[model samples]
Target chain A: MDKKRIEIKNEADIVLARQAGRKMAQSLGFGPADQTRLATAISELTRNVIQYAQQGIFEICDQSNRKAIIIRVMVEDFGPGIADLDKAMEYGFSTSQSLGVGLPAAKKLVHKFSIKSKPGHTKVTMVMTRKRV
Target chain B: MKIPILQLKNLLLTSIQVELTDRDAIDFQYDVVHKVAETGAEGLVIDITAMDVVDSFIARALNETARMARLVGAEVVICGMQPTVALTLVEMGRELIDVESALNLDHGFEKAQRLISAKKRMPG
Candidate 1:
């Protein structure tokens, strides 16, 4: 499966990325719940990409025959990376003025989530299944 | 811009009737919370069905309203949570622990009635 990538630079891009995630999920016949979850997760991550990273790329990939889709979003910037992954995942923890629910909410929406970050880069990957309930 | 306060049986329900877009969300939230608190209502029903998206700020304000209402011995119920709004909230991970939510206005009223009734039944 070819990876589909979108470079996000602002808040508007976050909205577009969410719509894209929902469209892809719907086209694959995922349930409404799953579709909403995926769209919301993507929106949260993409917003972070614009706010914290200043820019990032959102990539979507289809896993053949597994009835699953993989969303790998990488938000990269020269900004300071998170010093504590654990604290970053904690609810109500935020470095910005906005509500600190971004990372934790994204984690809750997917089956598999992983985060890798350095002093200048952050990559978050989440996997969702297309199987109907 | 005006949120009407309605009284139903011992419970005072205020419908949050505002068209808050992302642009005015911050101001709208602050105004709503303060007004609801001032009304001294026993309960509040915030209808956000007109809102298609709720950013982090709006979510935070809702949480703040819930807390404030509880402090004043009132309950806060959020209604008209569209699917997109719900998804955004879940994604933001904003804890609505302080505020109860329903799919629409009618359902929210039903739930609020139950909660208020239950509270009355509790041993004082």
Candidate 2:
């Protein structure tokens, strides 16, 4: 259960972070489907960081045991926080001319998701767990 | 990296062989449209068989590129999407809906040609 942190600065950082997430998920015995889910989720989150916050950090860790495996991810940025959390979470609503599915869709990929934001800081946390077979 | 766009008669072909950053995706959209216009191509087929991740940004870029190519008088076909990518997209709320797709490169070319000819027969 080692923790890893990635810096999110630009579009390239988004790709790097997602690749790292997928690699870690694969090593932890996750399936292709779940790996993809984690990777895609990370991609969206990091993208939001770049688009809105200009920069951020992507942190990942595993908390698991004999019968189940849990993956935890946190993306945080010190920038102008979201002006409206409710609208940002709504599907098909985007101020940046994007698909606006980044936040809500990312939430669906993981088992647990939460977010908090203020004037200078925003954090999104996600947990994905699967029982080992 | 800038992807190479090849030409075959009235058709233009390109394949995304690596994962692209957001800038690369936008550059690609620009490149595809300019290529179509430069060649006055009738059909364009983009093969993304090697791409493993088509997140919302890439998906939007692809759909936008398709729209721009169509506006510039070329029919577009996107082919060879990985099943996992397709599954992930579906889970992400149905992206890539604006473009035509096929099973593989051969089918993609055929589909693009069909679309091109179909448009050619239009009254306008």
Candidate 3:
């Protein structure tokens, strides 16, 4: 398993995280479409970190075995957590002036997604898996 | 990174060929709108053939740019969105619904010209 962690603090970090994630995905044999999806997913999540949390940690890990290759990502922040998780997931429900599609879009791009948030902490985890052919 | 906005007659042309940060995206939006107003251009073509990812932020930036250009009486056509990027954008549910798009730069220029002429023929 290979793991890499990046600090998400500002807009530049958002770009950095997504590029690194895309590079990792490419190195792991992900196709062009999947690579773009992974990069876009990372972009959305890291942007949320900058906009909402002010800072966070973005981790991408590769856990590939004989049968399948699994890529897992974790985003953790220490900002004021989402008060209404369900509402936040809804389309067009944005606290800011944004389109509010970040969280939901990130979720949709990945294979598995889950979120846990409190007042001072929020963690989002996502996984994408492809069978080894 | 600075995206150069080139003017050709009554049309403004620009291509986003870099991995843009949020700041870059916002700057590009501002630059395009300002260029449109300065040149009194009737049409604009933004090529994103090099952009492999069009997340919600970039998508919103492009949409806002197009809207701003239209407000200044310019027809905007975005072109050269990669197939993978389009797929990802659709799956993410953040479509660029507010903007006009074409398959490539040539087609986009043609479409933008057509729209500009059509608008000109309309009585204001």
Candidate 4:
């Protein structure tokens, strides 16, 4: 259960964090498509961090057992958290006026997804599992 | 010479082959619209097939560039988005409304041609 943490403070760090996620996925035997998924998800969360809070922390942890290789991710920020978590998770309810599809889309790409937020804190966690063939 | 947009025969083509830093994305938006002005191209095809990720920043840049291209009288068509990138964009709430997309580069050309022709026929 080793975890690698990244601090996202600006736009450039989002790129760096994605690169790190890609390398980790490769080393963990994630296929190109899944690597893209994980990396893209990281981008979504980290970009949210930079835009909303201006800074946040992300962690990627390996949680494999005898069955499958599991990649767990946690993204937390101290920015103003989502006021309406339900609306945020809805596919088209976007306050920022982008497509408003990010959170729901990320949920669809992973094995597990969860989120918690308040006035000054927001945390999102996702788990991606790959079969060890 | 690190040109962000390439022009050939009345169409502006840009392939995002690598992960673009935010600065690059912003500069790309600037150059693409101005390039439309310089070349007077009737169409634009942005191939993001080689790009593995299209985060919100990149998405905004692409969407803005599309709007700007339209403002300059050039039709824009996006092509070569991998399945994963498309899905990611969906989840990021970046539907990129108003941007036309095609399955691949070949189809993108066809779509752009149709759009260009349609624009020509419209009363200006």
DockQ scores of the candidates: 0.25, 0.80, 0.92, 0.51
**lDDT (Cα, tens digit) per residue for candidate 2, span A1-133:** 7789999988899989999889888999988888988999999999999999899999999888898898899999998998899998999889987889999989988889999999999999999898988
Report the lDDT tens digits of candidate 1 across residue range A17-119. 7777777777777767777778777877877777777887887766646543454444344556778899889987898886677788878878788988778
Which of 1 and 4 is ahead in DockQ? 4
Model 3 residue A97 CA deviation in Å: 1.4
DockQ of structure 4: 0.51
Residue-level lDDT of model 2, residues B1-118, one tens digit each, is: 8999999999999999988999999999999999999999999999999987888888999999999999998999999988888888888786545689998999998899889888
Ranking of all predicted structures according to DockQ, beginning with the best and ending with the worst = 3, 2, 4, 1
DockQ of 1: 0.25
After the best TM-score superposition of candidate 1, give how far the Cα of residue B92 lies from its true spot, in angstroms.
8.4
lDDT of each: 0.69, 0.91, 0.91, 0.83
Candidate ranking (TM-score, best to worst):
3, 2, 4, 1
Summarize candidate 4's per-residue lDDT along A1-133 as a digit string, tens digits.
6678989888788888788778888888988777887887788788888777899999888999889999899999999899999999887678875666677767766779999999889999999898877
For model 4, give the RMSD to the true fold: 2.8
Which parts of model 3 have CA positions greater than 4 angstroms off?
none
Residues A1-133, candidate 3, lDDT per residue (tens digit)?
7999999988989888999889988999999998999999999999999999899999999988899999999999999999999999997789999999999999889999999999999999989899999
Local accuracy of candidate 3 as per-residue lDDT tens digits, B1-124? 8999999988999999899998999999899999998889999999999998889989998998899999998999999999999888888884645588999999999999999989889998
- The candidate that achieves the highest DockQ relative to the unseen native structure: 3
Docking class of 2: high
Q: List the residue pairs that clash in candidate 4.
A: A99-B93, A100-B93, A101-B91, A101-B93, A102-B91, A102-B92, A102-B93, A105-B91
Candidate 3: CAPRI quality band: high
